[model samples]
Every structure is written in C-alpha cells, then in structure tokens.
Target: MRSHLLNDLTAEHYRRSVTEGVERVAARLATTERPFTGVTVDALAPRVERIDLDRPLHDTTAALDELEEIYLRDAVYFHHPRYLAHLNCPVVIPAVLGEAVLSAVNSSLDTWDQSAGGTLIERRLIDWTTARIGLGPAADGVFTSGGTQSNLQALLLAREESKPGRAAWEEGASLASLRILASEVSHFSVKKSAKLLGLGQDAVIPVPVDQDKRMRTVALAHELERCRQDGLTPMAVVATAGTTDFGSIDPLPEIAELCARYGVWLHVDAAYGCGLLASVRHRDRLAGIERADSVTVDYHKSFFQPVSSSAVLVRDAATLRHATYHAEYLNPRRMVEERIPNQVDKSLQTTRRFDALKLWLTLRTMGADGIGELFDEVCDLAREGWRLLAADPRFDVVVEPALSTLVFRYIPAAVTGPDRIDRANLYARKALFASGDAVVAGTKVGGRHFLKFTLLNPETTAADIAAVLDLIAGHAEQYLGESLDRAS
Candidate 1:
C-alpha cells in the first residue's frame, strides 16, 4: 500500500506502470480494424460479473492483461472512421497528454489553495473563450462536467434572475409560473434541467421548428405573447445553436431580438455548434451568439477535447453569485476580501477536477485554428455524404446538414408500406451494429424511423459513406425478404 502511493518516493513505480498502460492502449489503437467487435451484452457481462473486486491483482501487467479480455477488446473505438453514431470525437494527442498530467497531479480546481496556478490557467481559458463568443468585458464562467451541467447552471441563473421580477409583478410567483421556451427538437437536457430546477412538469414549452429543423421565430413570438396573456413568467428563451438530431442552427439574431423585446433571458445552448466559433469558414453561422445572456459550450463535442470538458458563460459575472456559497473551512466570505479566486464561487460543483488543463494544453499545442480545421473537415465530409444520400435512389435524406450530422433513411424501390419501411430501416441499423462493419445511429423524424450518420472523424470519406449505404441496403433487403418469408 505504501509503495502504491503516488509520491516522490514512488515516482519511478508510477512511471513504469503508466508507461505500460499507455503502451497497451497505443498498441490496441494501432491494430484496431473496426469501431466495435459486435460483442453482445450477454457474452461480455458474465466476464465482468465474475471478477471479484476484493481479490486484488498484485501486479500491474496482470491486471492490464485481464482488463484486455473484458474491456479493451470490446470497447467501441471512436477514432475508427466507421463510428458515425454519436457526437464523440477522436481526442487529440495534446489533450490526451494533458489528461495524463492532470490525472497524475490530482489538482482540485474548486479553490485557489488546492489548484494554485491551475485556477489562473482555467480563468485565462475562460476569458479566452468568453472573448471568442464576444460576450464583452464582464463575461465570466466556470468549467463544468459537460454540456448537461452547463445547461443546468445556465438555466439556474436564469431562474434566479427571473424570480425577483416575477415576484414583484404578482403576489406569489413560484417556480411553476416560470416557463422555458425552447425548440421541440432541442436537446433533451433542456427538459431535464427544468425538472431538476423544481419547475412544473409543463414548465418547458416546446416551440415549433421549421422544415429545416430550426426554431420558428414567429411561433416563438406567439408563445411569448401567450405566456404574457396567461400571466406566466417568461423566464428564458433557450435557443439552440446546433440541434442534436438535425444539427440545425436556430435563427439567433431573430431570437435574440425577441428575447430583448420580451425582457426574457436568452440562453444559447451551443454545445454542438461551439466548434463553429473557431471555424474559419462558418463563424458567421453563430453571428448573434454574442447577444446571448448565457451560453453553454461543450469542448468535448467539437473541440476534440476528451469527455467532461464544458463551461457555462454569462454576459454578467455577478449573475453567477446565484450558485455561490461560502464555507468556513473552504471558500470563506473573507476570501473575497482577500481577493482569492475560488472557482466554487460560480460553479454548481465543489472539488472539481482541473479539466481546463486539457483544453489549455490542446490550444497551446495545436491552437484554436487547428481544432477548427479538423471540425471543418468533418462538416465538409457531411456535405459530401448528404450529396451521396440525395443522389442515391435507395435513400431519402431529411435535410441538408448545417453542421456534421446527416439524417436519412433507406427506401426500397418497391411499393412497401411505411410500417415495413420503418422496420427495414430499424433492422438495418441493428444488423450493422451487430456485425461491427460500421456503427450508425437511429432516430424518428416526424414519427418515421430514420438512420443518422454523425461524421466527426476527418478520416471518414465519401467512399466510407457509400460503402455503409450499400451495407445498409443489403441488410434492409435481407430483413424484408425474411419478413415476407415469415408472412407466407
């Protein structure tokens, strides 16, 4: 136990153990041919269940070897070009190096005493990001676990800001009266946040989106008017910079103008589209993001940082006080007088990890332009894929992609009923996942089943898209044939 402790005396031991682990991971990555092994849960679960946690493997190499059998062999590799399932991106080398360093140092970023230089580094990064978003001089934010927490914190601030105004307007304005207007297609986290904030079940009023999947400003205006007429507090207008399913960017300038007119706090959930902030070619797509009262950015999604790197920025730094709490043993009230920078003063979390170091190292090594270029490649690839899906007679593409996601479904040439088509598409997605040839996602658009291809890897090309389409067609045809045989 003494030898295992990570101190100066055990530095050599730590070095050897970590080196061996890195080598195993690198070797596995180098040789990985597919995104997945298509291993079923039943087959893999028992191996994990059989392991006794109390029985410790005394040697690092032995533990790693055992880990290879149950975990590494079947772990889905996002770096693989065929992994077109989700928003996960292949992490950059520099960010991975940062992860290694930060994990070893184990710095808690909640207080200046715990993190020292790390607190300043995170603040500088926050300043850099807020400047990029053009949030002005008073802009400030704290790092969060991910976009979910970021969105939650943003909504929390909006709730706090709205409560006083609403209470003054009416006798008893409670959480139930607060309404959050957002697109019907916005990320599910918006609704989840509403529930967690103790708002009413119907607190999230879903605004209609256009054919492009972007929110309709006219409909939003109607909703705002209705809320006022109903004596409801229009707490916030949650506009999505990039919707999850369609990657559609809502009309930000129009939405911002409406929020200003209505005096509603504008919160831009730019989790997926924040990459466009760094985009050389598409920065204008996020033109009115600067007008947002609050913004959520997920670096892990588009910045190519590892998981759990996100932040919530505000135009007014003072608003973050809604989340602040002073403790005698920790962030005491006197610390403010002493000018001690405690991240917990603005965060919903305490004892937070120094996740900012990863982004810092990544920016230092590759710069924001490098990240933007990589994201641009994926977006460009998505356009090419859209063209392929549009041209192909076997598929029906939903809409032209605004970012890096394409939603389309297979359509058999024969006169098949919509139900059969739905089943065919669903079956095809499952079959492809089971085969491990290529992994794709599935969603329902307008109550009809559709397949989704989220191209985050720059290595994924037009050829890969073409090949995956053929595989899907083959699988769909096989399913239809099998269904017909069963019916007969």
Candidate 2:
C-alpha cells in the first residue's frame, strides 16, 4: 500500500477489469442464462483462484474455498430480472465499472488525503442530485450504505435540528417529549430509526391514510394538535414520497405546509421513489419535495446502481457541517486551510467508499434525462402489465401500480370461499419464490395476501409479465384441483 508501489496495480488493471466485467454483464442480461445463486463453499475451492479477495480481509481465509463457493452459488443476485423478491434490479454498466475502479484503490474518503479527488466528485454529484430534488445549491450530502443508514442519519439530524441545545447523543434527549410522524404505509425503517435514535417506538405516530393509502394531512394535523395538548413536542414529520407496500405517496406539498406551520423539520424518505425526481411527469407527484429539510435517496434503488449507494441531501448545506468532527491528524489545519469538503463531514461513516463515482459516471454516460426516461418507461410498463393481468378472468389485479410495483392475486373460480382463496394465494406466492421459478412474493393488503411484481428492470416486458402470470395461474389451478379432489 506504499505510495511508490501504488502504481503497480495502476490504472491499466482497472480499465481492463472494468471492460471485461461490464461487457460480460451487458451481454448476459438479455439472455437470463446466468446461474440464480452461488454454489456451496466445499464445492467451489477448485475455482477459488478466479474470484477476487483482498489480503487485508482474511476472517474467511481458512474457509476461502467454502466462502467463495457459497457466495458465488447462493447469493441472490439482484441483476437477474427474475430475481424480484425485493426492490432491486440490474445495475447499469457504467456504475458497475465505477464501483470496480474505486474498490481497486480502496480509498477511505474521510478526508482529502484519504479520498484524493473523490471528495470533490462526491460533493459535485450531491449538488447535482440535490438541485434536481428542488433543493438549492447550498445543499450538501454524502453517500451512505443504503436506505436504512440514510434514514437513520436523517432522523438523527432532525433530532439535532429540533433540539440544538440538548445533547441527545450523550445525555439522551431531554425533558422535551419527542414524537415522529409518518404515514401508516411508510417503511418500517422509519420506526426502527426513531427507536434506534432513543426516540422510542411509542413516540412514532402512524397517521391515517387516504383511500389511495397516502398519508392524510388532516389526520396528521389532528395528531399534532393532540400531541400539543398532551405536552408532547412535534419533533419531525416523516413524509414518504413512495410507501413501500403499494407505492403510495404521502401528499408532499400539503405535508410540507403542515411541517412549516408547526416549525417542525420535514424529512422526505424517498428511498424507493426518489427516482421520480428524474421524471418530468412524476416530479409533480413529489411536489414540495424541494422544501424538505432533509431527503434520502438511494442510487441503488432508483438509479439502477449496485447495493449500498445512498445519499442524504439537506436544504441547507450548513446542516451537514453539523456532523463534522475536527480530528487533528485527519482534518489538519493545512487541510482546512485548503478549504476541502471532507466527505466524512456530511456522512455517518468514518471510512466511506466512493459510491458517487458510479452515479457520476452513469450520469456522464447516459445523461440525466436517460435515467428519467428509464423511470417513466418502467412506471408505464407496470401500468401495461396491470392492464394485461386485469383483462384475464382468473387473475385479479389487487392494486393498480402506484409506482412500478403491481400487486395481483390468483382467485380461481373454484375456490369460492373467501378464506380458501386467501390461503391458496399465500401458498402459491410462497411456493413460487421458494423454488425461484418466476419470483413473485406475497404482501398483505386489506388483510389479504397478494402476489407482487415490482418491475424495476426496463428490460422486463409485457411478455415477461405475461409469462409470470401464466406460471402463477398454472400453480393456482394445480393447487385448487388437488384441494377440491381432497374434499370430494
């Protein structure tokens, strides 16, 4: 790792590796011929020499063969289009290459010396993304591991902003009664974040939702007033740009106004839905998103980057400087004199990776509009897929796609009993995913289980959707016949 020896692994290695990996992935994506999961460790040692593993990380050195086999053979790769158990998809080539190059260097990114030019690159990317979200240029942010960390950091910031005088981290939040507000449909991570912040789970208020499952501002105002009467302080309003369950978006403009009126911090958790910022059409869906005190966006989710590329941008850049730690060796006077924006200043991480490089490289190659177009196209494809499913008699479209996710259920006419139909749907969904045959999992809506198709892959088409539907219907028919014959 010496400065002189640094040139040994040099730029040429990264360039060649990037070219090979990207071309391999790009070519493989269309065919769906890649193995679904990694093999066992015991079986993979003979080929262990093929994969990359650094020497500094050696907890698994003894089990390298086993580890490599299991990781390569069993890991559920998000890149595969059929692998839709969660909100993930195939990462584009440029971003993947960006990740590869950064890993080769293994820069810390805590300070200028650690990150070199990465500090500037991350800051600029943050500025670009923040501007799109309607925040001013004064905004600043940092890349994080994923949505959970970003949400936690945002909540921590909200606590600090609301209680500037109180030492919440050390003394653990004062006599002030803190409460967190989020829609009923918001991600569970919101509550988890609040609890982890020492705000307590009881402090999280689950506001009522409209028919579409968006948070009701009227209910929120009532809850705030009720808390006021109870001597509770309204800490922050956690608005969801896209609810995880049905992609329901809490009314952003109205919530923003309510937060402003109450002088509460507005934190938008758009981890799943922030890609709408790229969309000229759906941008209005996230209206007033700009006014948010803080926003959480994951390049991993909407931007089609690999896992662990998340950013939390704030309206005021100085709010980020609040997290700054003045370490002498790290943030020396000379470094400060140079006016470097330490990536650590705005991040919860001490040794952060260069996640921005991917988004930055992706933007440079495809243009921002290209990403937006992908968003719009994926959303529209979800709608078309819904229509195709709804037209068929046996399959039921439970919810029209709110974003790119569609919830559907198979209710064969033979299963006339409501309870029976519910049981059948749940079983079918579980079985399909467990076998990894056209993965569609069950989600509860209105106390009933429905199979979900979260189509983030732009390559996913009507044909793919139709194929999944046929498999589901076939399973439903087979199961239903077995059940009826058993009864007879």
Candidate 3:
C-alpha cells in the first residue's frame, strides 16, 4: 500500500508529462501554425483505432499521444488569426498555468473546510472586481460556469432581494405578478433565465432601442408605468453594458435612475463589454454600470480567458446567504453556529471547480493596468476597422462605433429603394457565412438584418476587416446585384 501510494511514478512522471506536452505545443504556438482543422476532424472521426471492449486503461503514453495528435490536428483554435466566428479567442499564458495548478490540487470550493485557502483567493478576486464596479463594500460574488449561469444567478438574487424570505427556487414564482425590463438587443440568455427561473418568456418587457441599439429609456418608463397600473411586480430592469448584436451600450445612467424610482433591481449583463472598465479611453461607455444591483461579467469573453470563467456579483453579501441550503455534513451545525461562511451559499452549483485561480493568476501577472492597455488597444482598433468599412461606398456601417463591436454590410451604389439597404445587408451576410470562409455574426436592426463583427481579438487588424469586407463585396456582386436588377 505504501509503495503504491508513494510510487516511483511520483514527481518524475508529473514533470515529464507537462514538460513534454508544453514542448510539443510550443513549436506550434511559435510558428503561427496553420492546419485544416475541420478537414482533420472529419478524417480522424472514423480513422483512430480504439482498444477492444475488454481492454483496460493501458499505455498512458499512447493515450497522451492520441489526444495530442487530435488536439494539434483537429482543434478549432480560437487563437488563429482567421478563426473569427464568435466572441471566443486567444487565452493568456498566466491563466493557462493557473488552470494547471488548480487541476492538480483538485479542490472543491463549496465549504471553507473543503477549500480554506481557495476561499480566500476567490474572496480577494471578488472584492477587487466589486470595488472597481463601485458596488457595495460588502458586495460578494462567485465564479460561474459562464455568462448564462451568471445572468441566471443575478436574476435569482434580484428575485430574493425583492421579496424578503421568499425563496424563488423552493416556492417558485408566478409570472402574473412578474415583469423584467431589458432592451430588445439584450442577450437571449435573459429571456432564457427568466423562463428557467419560472417567470416564463412573456414576463420580459423588451424596450426598443434608438438608432443605436441601446435601450430606449422613454419607452422603458412607459412600460414600467403600465406594469404598475396593472398591479404587476417589476422583477428587474436589465441594462446592456455591451449588447451582443451591435455592441451598443445602453443608456445606463437613465436606466439606473428609472430603476431607482420604480424600486426595481437593476442588472447589467456586461459579459461582452465588462473589460472596458479597465480601459481609460472607453470607460465612458459603461459609466453607470457600477450603479447596478448586480453585474454579469465573463472573463472568458472580455479578459481572454478560457471558457467557463465568469461571475455574477451583487451589491450586498447577505443576499447570498438567502440563496444557500444548509447541510449538516458540509457546513455542519457547529460551524454554522460559529458563523462561518461557505461558497455554496452564493453559487448555484455544488462541487464547483477552482476556476477563480485562472483570473487571479492573470490579475497578478499581467497587472490590472496591463490588461487595461490591451483592452484600450482593441477598442481603438475596432474603431479604425469601423471607419474603413464606413468609408467604402460598397458597405454601409449600421451604427457608430460604441465598444469593440462593429455592425455593417455590403451596400450597392445602385440600390435606391428605402428597404434596399437592409435587404442588401441581409443577403451579403447570409452569402458570406454560407461559404464559411470566415464567420461574422448577423442580426436584424430596425426590423432589418445587419452584419456584425465581434472584435475581441487584440491582434485582429484593419487588414483582417478589409479581407472580410472584400469577401462581402465579392459575394454581394455575385448573388445580390444580378438577382435584384439595376433598380436595387
């Protein structure tokens, strides 16, 4: 038993594994590696040989080799320059190393006893983030799997805060008295969270945006008055720090004021735009985000971390205690009597991963200012890209640059109809994605489809935008121009 526990495979094996893996991947990272990732995935899907059903785990080296081959060969690398599909992109080195250490410890952070040191680390990060947002000095938060979970947690907290001692989870909720206000351009996750929280889809009140996609405050005030007159409870008012479609920042000051008057919880879904808090140049876009009762920020999207690193932060710490369930074995009667804190109190998950380490490591190594500099660089680049797109007569940018997102599409010189602009944008977007040479997002603006570029990559340059625009122009000329005739 002693030999097995302290086996010859102790330090040497661990060192060798990580060393070899890093060495293997380093050359690939260094040379700006390129591979036909999709084709490789298809080829290897049916080609890799697996052990027979009777075989047990064996030859760990063989397993590692197979996995590494698959990773280098088939991985959809978000780091690749031409790999712009979604908000996902390159991850920083410090956080990558943090993931390794956290995995080795394999700590479960539900209770203080389960993760004494980890609790402190997470607490520190939460406190730092909360302070930056100008939340309550006593505000607290927990790492979530991603933005979806963060938004759900925020809404759930708002529910608990609105009606004291009424557990939304245990007693559930009725939609007849519930209404959540948000922009039409808000993340789909808000409506999904409302439905998941038992509020139902119809409970959401989507206020229209002005020419920019920010929520129209005048429209929101009218809706709130209607709800009040109808004797419905206003659950929460959600503001977008950076909307998903066009990256338009909502009128946060106006929204926060409305919420204060109506006594509704103000929640900010800043999953995409939260990093701007670090940017001196662009921080004005999110000026009143700190006034929110809760904020959802995805380190994965904004801070260049791997997926599953995000948080939902509240202005007060005790509201978390309201969401907790006490178990004798975990918290224990003695500990509770002594007033000890547990993470499971605030989080929706049990047996949660030590995801906080990644963000913590990043903050320490890069410094807040370093990350801020990177953020400012990207925002500046996005503006430059937008300017270039707008200058081209063939493409019309839908809105002015707000954050790091750009919405524009191919506009033909001959198109003269009122709806022709939108019609052209829609076709150009569809044609570009159908070929899949590059993937840019698409959505309807003012009841018309508009193409979007979610520029989260700091290394993405004006040339990349030019290339994509060229694709749009070529596709539009081939498909739209001939089909619509000169009248368009």
Candidate 4:
C-alpha cells in the first residue's frame, strides 16, 4: 500500500504503472472497431457484480487484465467516427497530457496554500476567456464542475441582486415572486437550478421559440411586460446560444437590449457554442454575448478538452460575493486585506480539482486558431449533413442547423399514418444501437419522434452519415414489413 502512493520515494514505480495503463488504453483505441461493443446490460452486469473487490491483485498487469473484461471491453468509444449521438468530442493530445499532469500533482484549487501557481494559471485562463467574450476589465469568474453548476451560481447571484431596496419583504415572498424566463427548448438545468435555490415550482416561465427553435424576442418582451403588470420580479433572462437538440441560438442582440430596458440580469448559457469564441470564422455568430451580465461556457464540449472543464463569467466581479463565505480555517477576511487570491472565495465548491490546466495547455500547445479550425470543420460537416437530409426523399428535416446538430426523422413512402411513422423511426434508432453499426440519438419534435445527429467529430465523414442512414432504413423497413405480415 505504501508503495502505491505517488511521491518522490516511489517515482520509478509510479512512472512504470502509469506507462502500463497508457499502453493498454492506446492498444484499445487502435483496435476498437465500433463506438460500442453492443453488450447487453444483463450479460455484462453479472461479471462486474461477481468480482471480488476484497481480493486485491498485487501486480499492475494482472489487475489490468481483469479490468479488460469488465470495463474496457464494454466502454463506449466516443472517438469513433460513427458516434454521432451526443455532444462528446474526441479530446486533443495536449489536453490529455494536461489531465495526466494535473491528476498526479493533485492540486486542490481552493486557496493559495493548496495551489500556488495553479491559482494564477486558472485566473489567467479566466481572464483570457473573459477578454474573448468582451466582458470588460471588471469581469471575473471561477471554474465549475460543468454548465449546471455555473448556471446555479449565476442565478444565485441574480436572486440576491434582484432584492428590493425600498422595502424589505419576507424571505418566502421574495423567493416566490422571482421568475426566470428562458426558451421552452432551453436546457433543463434552468428548472433544476430554480428548484435547488428553493424557488417556487413555477419560477421558470417557458418563453416560446420560433420555428427555428430560437426564443422569440417579441414573446420575451411580452413576458417581461406581463411580469411587471403582474407585480412579479423578473430576476433573469437566460438566452441559450446553442440549444441541445436543434443547436438554435436565441436572438442575442434583441434579448440583451430587452434585459437592459427591463433592468433584469441577462445570463447567456453558451455551453455548447463557446467553441465559437475561438473560431475566427464563426466568432461573429455570438455577437451580443458581450452585453450579458453573466455567461456559462463549457470548454469540454467544443474546445476538444476532457470532461469537467467549464466556467461562469460575470461582467461585474463584485456580483460573485453572493456565493462567498468567510471561513477562518480556509479563507478568512484577513486574507482579503492581504490581497491573497483564494479561488474558494467566489466558488460554490471547495476542494475543486485543477481542471483549468487542460484548457491552458491546450491553448499553449495548439493556439486558439488551431482549436477554432477543428470546430469550424465540424460545423461545415453539419451543413453538409443538413443538405443531404434535405435532398433525400426518405427523410424530413425539421430546420437547417445553426451550429452542428440536425434533427430529422425517416418517413416511409407507403406509411401514411403518423403513429406508424413515429414507431418506425424509434425502432430504427434502437436497432442501430443494438447492431453496433452506428449510434444515434432520438428526441420528440411537435409530438412526433425524430432522430438527432450531433456532429462533433471532424473525423466523421459524409459517407459515414450516408451509410448510417441506409442502416436505419433497413432496420425500419424490416420492422414495418414484419408488422404488416403479422396484421394480415
């Protein structure tokens, strides 16, 4: 057990162990043929459950051999070209190197004492991002676990800032009257954050989106006026830069102006679209994001970084005081006067991992332009996919993609019934997943089932998309033919 610890004394042992693990992963990556193994849960669960955890394999190679069956053999490979289901991206090499270094050092980014240079590195990265967003000199932020935590912290700040100065109301009344306006297609985290903040169930009002799935600015203005007439406090307006299913961006300039006129806090949830910040060609897409009071960005989604890399930036640094607490044992009031920078002072989490290193190293090794080019490639690929879907007679595309996702459903020429079409599309997606030929995602649009392709992998070619479509058609036609035969 003592030999297992990573320190100066066991440097050789640590290096050898890590090298072996990396070799195993490299081999798996080279040999994996499909995105998934198509292994059923029922068959795989028993093997994992029967493993004797109490029996420790002393040798690293032996332990790895056991791991091959229960974990690696069944793991979903996101790097595969056919993995067009989710927002997961294949990570860059420099970021993976950063992950290796940060994990071994084990720096907790709570205070200066825990993480010395790590603190400065994270702060510098935050400053670089805020500058990219044009958040001004006073802008500040902290790294969070993901977009959800970032949104929660931003809303918490909004809740405190919306308090009435002329009159002191009961705590329950204040919480009840607060409202958050977001597009109906916005991420579910807005509602979850409201619940966590002890707000009423109806605190989040669903603003309708246009056919493009973007929040209608006219409807948003109407909602703001309604809130005023009804004597409710409009705490914040969450403008989504890229919706999950449709990749639709809300009208940012209009929404920001509305927030200014209404004096409401504007929060732009740009988690999926933040990669555009690095994209020279597409940076103009996020035009009015600079006017937002706070913004949430997830580098993991588009920056080709690993998971758990995201930040919440604010235009005004002082607003972060809402999430702060003075603890003598950790971060005290004396440290503030001494100008000692403690990251925990503005974070919702303590003992935070040094996740910013991944992005830092990624930027240093592959400059912002390098990251941007990769993102642009995927966006261009998505446009090509949309064109293919639109021209095809067998599919019905909902809307042209604004970012990198396309939502469409297959329609059989003979299938006149809507319900039957829905069932066929559903069957096709699951069948594709089970066959391990390709992986796709499904969602409902206007009460009709539809399939989605989130093209985050630049390696996924147009031919792969065509092949997957053919596979889906084959599976769907098989099911529909069997159904008709049974009915006759």
TM-score of each: 0.98, 0.86, 0.88, 0.98
Per-residue C-alpha lDDT of model 2 across residues 401-458, encoded as one tens digit per residue = 7688877788787637877788788777665655555666568878887888887888
**Local distance difference test values of all predictions, in order:** 0.95, 0.77, 0.78, 0.93
Clashing pairs in 4: none
lDDT winner: 1
How far residue 216's Cα lies from its native spot in candidate 3, in Å, is 0.6
* Alpha-carbon RMSD, each predicted model: 1.4, 4.5, 3.8, 1.4
Q: List clashing residue pairs in candidate 2.
A: 37-73, 38-72, 38-73, 38-74, 39-73, 41-66
lDDT of 4 by residue, 82-128 (tens): 99998899999999999999999999999999999999999999999
Write candidate 3's Cα lDDT for 162-259 as tens digits: 75216444676444578888898899999998888777558898999899878999999999999889887888999988888777889899899999
How good is model 1 by TM-score? 0.98
Model 4 residue runs over 4 Å out of place are 164-173
In angstroms, the error of model 3 at 350 is: 0.9
Task: Sort the predicted structures by TM-score, highest score first.
Answer: 1, 4, 3, 2
* Local lDDT at 171 for model 1: 63
